[model samples]
Target: MRQWLFALGGLLVWTAHFFAVYIAASLFPGEPLASWLTLGLTLVALVVVGWLGLGAWRVWEARGEDELRPWLGGIALMGAALSAIAILYAGLTAVFF
Candidate 1:
């Protein structure tokens, strides 16, 4: 039940990110930087959402399994690493540009 909820939440997050990007691009077709900003934000959001969805899937897979701890740990680690990279990129982009 919890796993399903988490998966649903991840799906919602993914959908929301796409919708936001699409709306931004559609509404500001002629604005400079609009597409770039939308793409950048969408990329970041999608990566984060993918990590979360992967984590949720891992949790779902681990529910009744005995040897799933390692996989779950790996998922968490991967998610954290990706998030860190995204943060680093955003910070650098903000500072330099």
Candidate 2:
């Protein structure tokens, strides 16, 4: 449902970005186009993850007495952080190697 999607959005975006970068690298090989595409994807992914993290932050702050909501928000926030790290690593590798 919507809740589940929100919780997993970071991981989903990370996965998609990873695959897209991989595909671009494969398609372009050593071409500069591949590096450019990876850079663009990395920037997009960072922005999206940041937005998702902000949403999760709001959810976490507004959890109040809802224990489940807080946990969901924390998980989402952590996932977003992890996804951002992954995206950065993949982007750098694709661009440099």
Candidate 3:
């Protein structure tokens, strides 16, 4: 159901994001294109996270902040934010190194 996904979509995106960056790093080491592609991917992933987070927040609002699952919505928002930060960190680190 939409409710269930909104509560956990972020973490799923984060998992895919983690693999994409790491795989790009390992599979295309020393390639300039790969580095740029990774950066591009990071940005795209961030946008997706933001969109999903906003959607989740909207869903939470619509649900009246379910007393029994308030944490579910909050966690989704937090996870999206944390994952975005992680993506930025990875991209910056790669750029610098």
Best candidate according to TM-score: 2
- Residue-pair clash count for candidate 2: 0
Residue 4, model 1: Cα distance from true site in angstroms: 4.8
Candidate 1 residue 15 Cα shift, in angstroms, is 2.2
Which candidate number has the best lDDT? 2
lDDT by residue (1-97, candidate 1, tens digit) is 5534443454455456556655766777767566576657656765776677567556546655556555554555454445445544543343234
Global lDDT of each candidate: 0.55, 0.93, 0.76
Candidate 1's TM-score: 0.48
- How many steric clashes between backbone atoms does each model show? 0, 0, 0
Q: Please report how far candidate 3 places residue 89 from its true position, in Å.
A: 1.2
lDDT tens string, model 2, 1-97?
8889889999999999999999999999899999999999999999999999999998888857778998899889999999999999999888888
Those runs of model 1 whose alpha carbons end farther than 4 Å from true positions after fitting are: 1-4, 63-97
Pairs of colliding residues, candidate 3: none
Higher-scoring candidate on TM-score, 1 or 2: 2
Model 1: residue 24 alpha-carbon error in angstroms? 1.4
The TM-score ranking, best first, is 2, 3, 1
